[model samples]
Target: EPEVTQTPSHQVTQMGQEVILRCVPISNHLYFYWYRQILGQKVEFLVSFYNNEISEKSEIFDDQFSVERPDGSNFTLKIRSTKLEDSAMYFCASRTAYANTGELFFGEGSRLTVL
Candidate 1:
């Protein structure tokens, strides 16, 4: 079985600091997504990437947030300026094709804590 892997499992940073969360998604997956879950809320979609372009994004994904597949295997989410509300469990996920067939593989998560 394959799985997505994220780095810096837990990060603590002060407000206004820059933060970059990294993930290496399953090699064969075609679609990649970034999601965030506030402490007690359901997961919210941030952005979806395919073919080196953004396929979709949510309102929460403002100018301050950006996603890029820098190379063959790494996908990254960068928040230029952290805020208290930015603290949450950020998840990276990928699926081989579409939601109808392949299962979405999710990384354990990169927990961000903004002080």
Candidate 2:
């Protein structure tokens, strides 16, 4: 079975630098999303993208963030300016169909750490 994959399972960056976390969502899936777990917090949705545009975004998705489908299988999340608070496990998830109400399959996660 196909599964979501994330790169650089761990990343370290200086504050104010930009970082782009990468993910390959399950093949044949349509809905893609980025969610973050801030250290010891619950996973929170950052943004959801479909049809090449953002379907929904949370308040946490401020000016510093952007999502892109740079290619057929790759989805990316860019943080323009990292902060200490940005330290977290950024998860990339996808569902075959959101309307199905099934579980969202997530990547192992890209752990981002800002110094």
Candidate 3:
């Protein structure tokens, strides 16, 4: 079975620092997405990428955020400046194909902590 993998399982940073969360989705997946859950809040979509370009993005993905697939096998999300509100569990997800019933595979998540 294929699954998504994330790096730096846990990270602690200062409020004004930068952070990069890495993920590797299934080899054959076509769509990749980044989502986050702020402690007691619901999971929120950040952005989606396909064919090396951004396919969709939520308002949360503003100027302070950027995503890149530096290598064919890896995807990364970078936050230029972290804020206390940025502390949360960031998840990486992927789907083999888009369909009415397609299922998304999610990574264990990289927990970010900002002080």
Among these predictions, the greatest lDDT belongs to 1
Candidate 2 regions with alpha-carbon error over 4 angstroms: none
| Minimal lDDT window, size 10, model 2 | 95-104
> In candidate 1, which residue pairs clash?
none
Q: How much lDDT does each candidate structure score?
A: 0.96, 0.94, 0.94
lDDT tens digits, residue span 1-115, model 1: 7899998899999999999999999998889999999999999999999999999999999999999999999999999999999999999999887666868899999999999
For model 3, name the residue pairs that clash: none
**Distance from true position, residue 49, model 1, in Å?**
0.2
In model 3, where is the ten-residue run with the lowest total lDDT?
94-103
Looking at model 1, report the run of 10 residues with the lowest lDDT sum. Answer: 95-104
Q: Cα lDDT for residue 93, model 1?
A: 95
Model 1 score (lDDT): 0.96
State the lDDT of candidate 2 residue by residue for 48-115, as single tens digits.
99989999999999999999999999999999999999999999999986647877899999999999
> Which structure is stronger by TM-score: 1 or 3?
1
